[model samples]
Target: MMIHGFHSSRQDFSFGPWKLTVAKMHVMKSANVEKLADELHMPSLLEMMFGDNVLRIQHVSGFGIEFNATYALKCVNNYPGVLKVACAGEWEESRTMGEHYKEIIRPYDWTYTTDYKGTLLGKALKLKVVPMTDHIDTEKLKAREQIKFFEEVLLFEDELHDHGVLSLTVKIRVMPSSFFLLLRFFLRIDGVLIRMNDTRLYHEADKTYMLIWAIQGLR
Candidate 1:
């Protein structure tokens, strides 16, 4: 089973320094497992029966901060009434010095919550940041700098659950900075996480032209 696309709508709103964008995608009433698998780009149909729907959110700031989170509504034995949920995310920051200024938080671990409403989780991971060559000795670069990149707290609550209606509510707070941004995603079928990739090319010595290529040859 595979799904190609869906009907969706997007809305954007801003308040002070905070910006919010929401995208709602409707699942086709007659959509089957194959269609769902195609829409999610999953390789196997068996995986499609596990997760019935997905919700994804991402926040990015001009200051090089990136955060992504995803939630999946899973069905037990293809029974819609028996459901389980999973959530996870990744956070990172980078500055103008190309990859040298990059800092990454360790990959997040997914956790389940029985109470969809009033559920809160807090986690702290080791942060690793690259050292600047001009300010620090070359030998010292071997030992990257470590700091408390951010503290994250996740809050989830159920918003709506009428017949043929499914909604997920999520609230998150990141500490040490006061920037707010939001982008919402609603996906039918599970395991789809929203992601963004920003790439830049830097100059190298010898003044010769250099080009990098990414090959996606099928096996």
Candidate 2:
């Protein structure tokens, strides 16, 4: 988690009543804060990290007690003068100090409250007081589409081979779902089909990798 040497004094902890110490307020103000992730129906992101399963992050600078989507929605619904609340997915911003901020939030969707209601705490915090809630969208891709796409694009190989100075053999079944294209090569040496090596190629747009087995012939 990131500590900006600033503290806040919030009370409700559910929404705007929760305040950050003055120091933290200054930090948030000075830093360009952004959400990096947007998930649904999950507790605070940090809570999940504490569990036995290790959580993985990409391009993460640090962690913190982030603004809760539910809390933000509630504050917007109940309190006046609250601004709009919205869930933001992975975000990165270039800031003045030559430091970049990247972060992720959960539930992928959020509510917005306006600050026109003017709660004393909200005024002090200079925030609109949006509260996040349990209302989450449950939309998913259709099963047929998923299956059809996978069937055409993805393939698995039970065995593969490579040819080099000496032939090599592998026993694992490699799948093509993750990578763009997978090529398998087999070489005959001493009446035995052997595998030389495996190469992985990644597609830039989707960031997917393709494996090419037995690529030793090229320099």
Best by lDDT: 1
- For model 2, what is the error of residue 62's alpha carbon versus the real structure, in angstroms, after optimal superposition? 40
lDDT tens per residue, model 2, 52-143: 11111111212112222223223222222122212111110111123222232123111121111111222223322244342211121111
- Give one digit per residue, the lDDT tens place, for model 1 in 116-140: 2111122342122343333212243
RMSD in order of candidates: 20.6, 26.6
What lDDT is reached at residue 108 by model 1? Answer: 19
TM-score of 2: 0.16
Native-referenced Cα lDDT, model 2: 0.21
Cα error of candidate 1 at position 97, Å: 56
For candidate 2, the clash count comes to: 56
TM-score of each: 0.22, 0.16
